[model samples]
Target: MLLAHPALLADRVREYETLSALDADEGGAAARRRMDDIAYSLCVATGTADVDAAVVAARHRLPGARVHDDSLITAMHRLRR
Candidate 1:
């Protein structure tokens, strides 16, 4: 979606990143995690329809990145209403 048209979601990540920066701690680790969450959500949302490709792309984006166990990804995937 947005990838096909980068501009569509261009500022979104930056906006979220800025929001994350506000919560900077321990030299911005919290902010980094927030950025990761933002990216993960985008990829996951895109991947839900194409799980394989999306997961691969997301993983590639963070090859050695270790996501926190208690991150928001699980909660985002769980909410159903």
Candidate 2:
């Protein structure tokens, strides 16, 4: 959705990351996952071709992501001013 229509969800990923970072690990496996998410978001924000690579990196980090599916879904619907 982000890469396909970045305008629709500009900075949303950053919002998600910021909120997630409040409790996200500093430098653990989970942190790496969040970093992947950050990278992905940044790519989306910049309309960069690197979004694909970011997704792949995020996928590789999924096992250690430790993020619950419900949380992700909730994040998708959430928006910060």
Candidate 3:
């Protein structure tokens, strides 16, 4: 599995969060389309099936992720092993 570059992942995560915070009417169709694109990219980058999960995974993969921060996915993955 190819990992996405940390910088690219960070950018996508920021873009997704920013778009998500907008009011539906404020963002409109263009923002919706862009959000969808960013969500897809994030899912692909993090190898996750859901946008929420993808976002969490992307954050954990970011450069400054705290070593002590054990997210759900990380915990689940650990249990699987």
- Which candidate ranks first by TM-score, i.e. highest? 3
- Candidate 2 residues lying further than 4 Å off, grouped into runs, are 1-26, 51-81
Candidate 2 lDDT, 1-81, residue by residue in tens: 433343323344445456455755456787668666766675665456675454443443433444445766677778542
- Local distance difference test scores for all models: 0.50, 0.53, 0.90
What clash pairs does model 1 have?
A: none
> RMSDs, each prediction?
14.1, 13.7, 7.9
Error of 1 at 47 (Å): 1.2
Report the Cα lDDT for residue 38, model 3: 94
Better of 1 and 3 by TM-score: 3
Tell me the tens digit of each residue's lDDT in model 3 across 1-81: 999999999999998888888743266788778889999999999999999999999998998797577688898999999
- Predicted candidate 1 versus true structure: per-residue lDDT over 1-81, tens digit per residue: 444233323444455546645654334676767666665665654554443454444443443435555546778778842
lDDT of 3: 0.90
Over 4 Å off, model 1: 1-27, 48-81
